[model samples]
Target chain A: MISPDHFQALFDPRGIVVAGASTHPGKFGFVALHNILSCGYRGEVFATNRERAEVLGRPTVADLTEIPHGKADLVFVCTPATSNPEVLRQAASVGIKAAFIASAGYGESGEAGLELQLQLVEIANELNMVIVGPNGQGLVSTPSSLCAQIVAPYPPAGSIGIASQSGNFVSSFMNLSRQSGVGISRAISVGNAAQVGILDMLEYFADDPKTSVGLVYAEGISDGREFANRLEKVCQRMPVVILKGGASGLGARAAASHTGSLATDDRVFEGLCRQVGATRASSVAEAFDIAAAFSTLPAPRGPRLAVVTTVGGWGVLAADAISSTSLELVHLPADLRDTLDGLLPPRWSRNNPIDLAGGETKDTVPAVLDAVVGHEEIDATLVLGMGIQSNQGRLEREGPFYPDHGLERIVAFHDRQDSRYADVALAASIAADKPVLIASELAIGDPNNAAVAAVRATGHYCFASAERAVIAMHRLYERTVWLESFGEPNNERH
Target chain B: MSRTLSESDSKDLLAKYGIPFLPEVLISQADHVEDALVGMTGPYAVKLCGPNISHKSERGLVRLDINGVDAVRQACHELFDEARPEDGATGVLVAPMATGLREFIAGVSVDPVFGPTIVFGVGGVLAEAIADVTVRLAPLRRYDAMDMLGSLRSRSLLETFRGEPAVDLEALADLLCSLSDAAVGIDGLESIDVNPVMIVNGLPVALDALVEFSDVEVEP
Candidate 1:
């Protein structure tokens, strides 16, 4: 294991230098340097180019040794693979502790590239510096507001930390974060993993104070036992959601070509996840949703769940989703049913879902949510179709009768009420020490919906569908169960 | 590079590690059948045992449900006669016929990446077709063994089945742990296949076992 200071240098460097800074708009050298300076990275920035010139309005040095001593702690290597060894040696001489090599043509490119990758590892080891990727995308550390990657869209700063074996998936996750407004603390793509691997980044996340949950995308594991051991240690501190890529024969072959990875048997990998108590997601979307839930919600005490829905179909969908998981859809006890009956219409379903049946008054949704989330038998509550009011309000505001009928005031009131419902659900969940997952298609269909905005304002993700909400709750419940297996309390992390 | 142990030798090696096997006796000649059955019960299965004869039943060298001593003697003589010259037939193994309502397969195979892994699941002739199993890395903890049993998709079979008691999970867990121990302790061990681990009134007993060794010499 590397020292904490080394990881800190990788993630929270004081100053940074781009090895191959360029003025051309097409080159990664330009983009990497542009993203760092543009994303509000408050540090000393330097560039090394073949010729001494100004790039991105910053004077470029012809070599790394030109940088003053103790000025730059990290280097973003954009030079080709053949020159990386000399670049690393120069960076080491100048007191740089970490390097993110954005250059390709390394281990994934075959024999000669593999040899070059070995040289890079030897230099990293000799210098005792963290080398992120020899053929990978860049990384992001929101604490420093550093989006040093060559990609666009730096996500909002939040708790979920991501490490992926593939660069495109990192970009995809960041894109989801940008669209959904669920921020990230740190994200790195360990391409080819010449010097630093996924486990190293994950362990760093485990010790990182800003990160509450970890999302990992792995195509292969070089050492199964070591991977399991390190992963188990990380899970003890925070929940981890994993998405494995190469689980099938065809996928394994593809992975072998993609990153020179050897895929283990998918079943064994599945069993290993279960044994280590890491939540395994079947898709990238599912992995992010699960990680979002872990980042925001408290672990549930048990599997019992209460579904509160505005419509019957969402409730039915939530119920159907619950049937496939270990989560139990609790039967509404008589007392809770009576409480909901008092708060809802006579036609409302009195069962577990407690469907409002379109009969909710202004206060009905919030009052019913409080009653369900506060119930003793319910470990968590899933509120479905929450943004319907705001969704409807947007539609009516677009019509011709908007201001003529005093519709402006009515839409404003509807939006406020929708936002209030989100606040009340979140508040009630905190008061009851349970998880309340709010889901609506409007989260994805209409990102500007009031309820969606409200949930995002509090730094919690509003799930796109009932099934996605159910999957999140199920993962939370699994984490709780795993904690109990170690005789640890669920709320200890909180 | 690897050689399979004979049925009698496999059972002997596994019995040393606390894997329960039915009481049986080995006889080199048919004349010793009556004496070998002195303490054991009748209604036995007699099979030709040899280092090279790994699939005795497939080769029609196995006879079951012999009641009388003369019947057992006749079955042993027929089994020995049925053995071909290349079979390298060394002896005959006779064990009392045991009945059970449920069968399970438990074994240890070295995974290329994960090393020795324990596999447990539904057993019998359709075991391969059913393909219902779960694995855990070797040197399993007690809880890991329990998790393996619980993880099996056919886990319901371990419950009380057809008026018999539920499988003794503690003993079964112990068996799995012992297998894991052997996986780590034994030298040059390639694999161990214990199929049809019959559940009799809830207790598990290994009815058939095949232990393979690689790059090592062992007496047949």
Candidate 2:
């Protein structure tokens, strides 16, 4: 029954204390201390370590008792798992509102760990205090510019908020967010989730004004009906992306004891996702990429796509990618077909991939992009950067630019650098609103480097292959459609 | 939307829906059975009925193929005399025997995911063992009733299994459809179970049925 306003205490705190903080590098406590400082939090920040009087040049207390204020709005218990009980008991005596247990090796270890976790939960309940996790990475706030962990950088301050169970996976995801340029509003690691579980966080984020797109990295979920209902309500207004690990049996058990989560038959979750319009990603990378695209891109009008390339073979390969996804290689409209036919030599594939055959100039790239992207039927556009490089190189071999102008002057001033083509593609991306994928054949494994990076620098997609790009683009389209179509609580329309 | 009526309420509910039921009296105590027997026809069945009691046949609440006042009087006393009153007791039910029946089972339930549903199958032990049942979304159409009847693996029961005459399946389908229709129409209905829906010769009749109500506010 609690709404967004009630959840403010968890995300926005007036004061924060990083217990067990240190100046030492590579330690979890030190990393957490550094992250809190880096997030630009204006609130009161305190650090405590047994040995040091100062940590990262900030004044450190000998223990919780040394803080002059005598109390904190939130306490981050970053000590060993075994020491958490005593630390929590001491903190509770002073009426600490919330404490995040960033210690690992709790219920996830075995029966002994589970008993310890249960004891911690009982302690928190008795003291009327809230514990975030017994084995959690802690929480981050991009809107408030507050991060509680040292393992990763804050996501680029966007509307999407993520809650994950696996700290390592979530940390990696946060790192990936930096690489991909996808920002987040909040990313919380609810490890073990002994006191505050996914349901509580989900309800918090569902009504959270800062979050327009939601991502959950879950091992499993309990209370299927309640989760389904709550998510269905949230999905109507925001896209809720889900990545569930442990498709196998052993993983299912680990998932359960880690968070007291229910892992039902896999198909049940699949069916539920389909019914509720939640985007389900198979892997961590896919989850971030899909979440990235969904949060950043506009809704595509249709599934029809146009692949514009400078090479015929690259065009054929790009077309092949559409076979796996829902996207269709629509027939080029007659006017645009005629336009490409007139611009290219008769040898060019009149159909698509308008192979410039190395004869097309830098200016021609933008022109062709404009023609393809402006076509009414095209849902998205993919430009092959490798095709531009090889084809334009071939054209250079067959002709001289000018006899009047010197070769150095012509090459330096007029011809433009090899990477300029990426800029033109990026411009088309901005105009199209559809995902513009720049494919690099030379860098087969990591196409987003150099040439593809050239395009992505302009804020477009840089994929390894046309097929992968098409799949990503199609899934993004489906996610947008789903976000638009979901029902609002009891007022289900369809 | 499927509404369930208690045994006494079920009889009244079904009769109003045009389900032909045997004329009977619902006596609260064993002493009232002697008075109730005068109105009942000979060769009548005697049974105990209450809200808390379901599947009374297994509980020895039912006695069938009986004749004469002494047999009816004895069966009634046996049912009511041994009854435990503390078990959310409603009352005791006494009804005449429905003879010449080819038994079948009918019920209505509201599935959490799919909403109101109706169930049909063969009656008695075979129904439990084989579970030859069919389910249709409730407030069913005429075609849906036919579809449900045809769906069961023992659908041949509707068309003269052994020497039994082809139960008037069209008539039975109509009855099922009407019950589902009534269930949807009722305000407080939750679940309905009409077991041993006796098909006597060609005509169908209800031998026993039960209904459970929703938690709607009731006037005291």
- DockQ score of the complex predicted as candidate 2: 0.03
i-RMS of candidate 1: 9.6
In angstroms and one decimal each, the interface RMSD of every candidate reads 9.6, 13.5
Writing each residue's lDDT as its tens digit, candidate 1 over A164-243 gives 99988898888889888888999999989987888888888988998988899999776778888889899888888999
Docking class of 1: acceptable
For model 1, the stretches where C-alpha displacement exceeds 4 angstroms are A247-264, A492-494, B38-43, B60-74, B82-89, B162-165, B218-220
What does candidate 2's lDDT look like per residue over A1-494, in tens digits? 33332245457767778888967778888888888888798778888888856878888876776654544667888888788787777776654567888887789899998998999988877776778887788888877788987467676676667888877776777776666555778788889998877757766776777766678887766555566667767766567788888642322221101001211234345535654567788877777766766665566767787887766777888787786566788787889978877776677676755566665754676677778887777877877645344334334444676333454444333324445666766666567665566655443444334454454455444555666566667776665544444322211110
Off by over 4 Å in 2: A1-14, A23-26, A38-43, A50-52, A65-73, A80-97, A109-130, A153-160, A202-212, A247-264, A386-423, A441-450, A480-494, B1-220
| Decoy 1 TM-score against native | 0.92
Candidate 1, residue A432: Cα displacement in angstroms equals 1.7
